[model samples]
Target: MATDDLVVPEAAGAQYRETMPSFAQERFWFLDGLVPGNAAHTLQQSYTIVGPLDVTALADALTAVVRRHDVLRSRYVPAEDEVRVQVDAPRPVDLPVLDLSTEP
Candidate 1:
């Protein structure tokens, strides 16, 4: 069975727009239905940098990187024949507050 057959078709009135997925991205798109999104198919890394933390700077740097790489902020749509990828310009992302200071 093809991946497209697994996904529900879009609405008739819905606007359809997307770019063709790269070869690498296409491989993953085909496996999307076969494999779970939460499952690990690639290497995983955990990082812990100890120092006077600069959250603001870290977030800013990440935002800049996102703006530079379209793939980082792109959306994917699977079609019967091919996979579609769309990218929109990056915008400011607000960080939510989480105070764990009281936790033991």
Candidate 2:
């Protein structure tokens, strides 16, 4: 039999509401100010596909994901004494595809 579906918890309130940064975000902001160009707070991910891939379709898929998720297009703006979260309008995601298939 199939296992029970995982229950995903939702945020307690409305979506895209104006709000200030959390403690962690505040700390990251301060640390970023102290150490510019630090990769400590950055997250990197990679995936490999062994079959034929459509570059345009992949870009469209990524753009669709950004359109559906507000956080993907969010930016931090400095306020009076703290930083505020600002959600930007979803736009086309510029995904550059490099053709390295000829490399041996």
Candidate 3:
């Protein structure tokens, strides 16, 4: 297939808006995979911070977030390395905690 044919559906446009809840009232976060020559593939996560949250709960919620979105759980097919979106068990993601209290 031609290089152009390898392009996946654009998930950052108006079409995606239709699939997302109102950002004003809901907390939505995006996770993207590293795909060369393509725009950042985003996965929308439904998240809420209730008082003080635990690390385990944070991990669980992040996993749940990936589970809730097909793109985040997808893997690239072999051969031509074509992108394929799928529904599967949640993959573990190591998220780094950053301290942003320091001024730049």
Candidate 4:
């Protein structure tokens, strides 16, 4: 029934599952569902630049960071008994544009 966190197809070999979630990870995961849309545990910042940002470079940087850190590419999977981390290889991502330029 579980499809490797629904990211990897069941036909795509065996999914790699890491160890169980840490205390902090478990706590945060619980709070995430208990308080959806809460930003208390999140860190967000905005930047103002004078020129257009290289989206390609930004994507590459994000992918690189994910590749370098296995935790970033992992998610907790709950099953019949316990929860474990499922880590997958980094995939390419294309940034989406809002095109708010025309908005008044």
> Candidate 4 versus the native: TM-score?
0.61
**lDDT over C-alpha atoms for residue 51 of model 2:** 84
lDDT of 4 by residue, 22-79 (tens): 6787788778778977999888899765577887898888878877887887878876
- What ranking emerges by TM-score with the best candidate at the front? 1, 2, 4, 3
Q: Write the per-residue lDDT of candidate 3 for residues 1-104, one digit (tens) a residue.
A: 45345444455432221122223212212122233444444446787555665777778888788868755654433223222332344566676766444768
Judge candidate 4 against the unseen true structure and give its global Cα lDDT, from 0 to 1. 0.70
Poorest stretch of ten by lDDT in candidate 1: 8-17
Candidate 1 residue 98 Cα shift, in angstroms, is 1.5
Off by over 4 Å in 1: 1-17, 36-38, 42-44, 49-51
Model-by-model lDDT, in order? 0.68, 0.73, 0.46, 0.70
On residues 41-71, what C-alpha lDDT tens digit does candidate 2 reach at each position? 6899999999899889999999999999866
Per-model root-mean-square deviation over C-alphas: 7.6, 9.1, 13.8, 6.6
Write model 1 residue lDDT over 16-49, tens digit each, in one string.
3245667788788778767758455666789867
Candidate 3 vs. true structure, TM-score: 0.35
Q: Pick the candidate with the highest TM-score.
A: 1
Per-candidate TM equals 0.66, 0.64, 0.35, 0.61
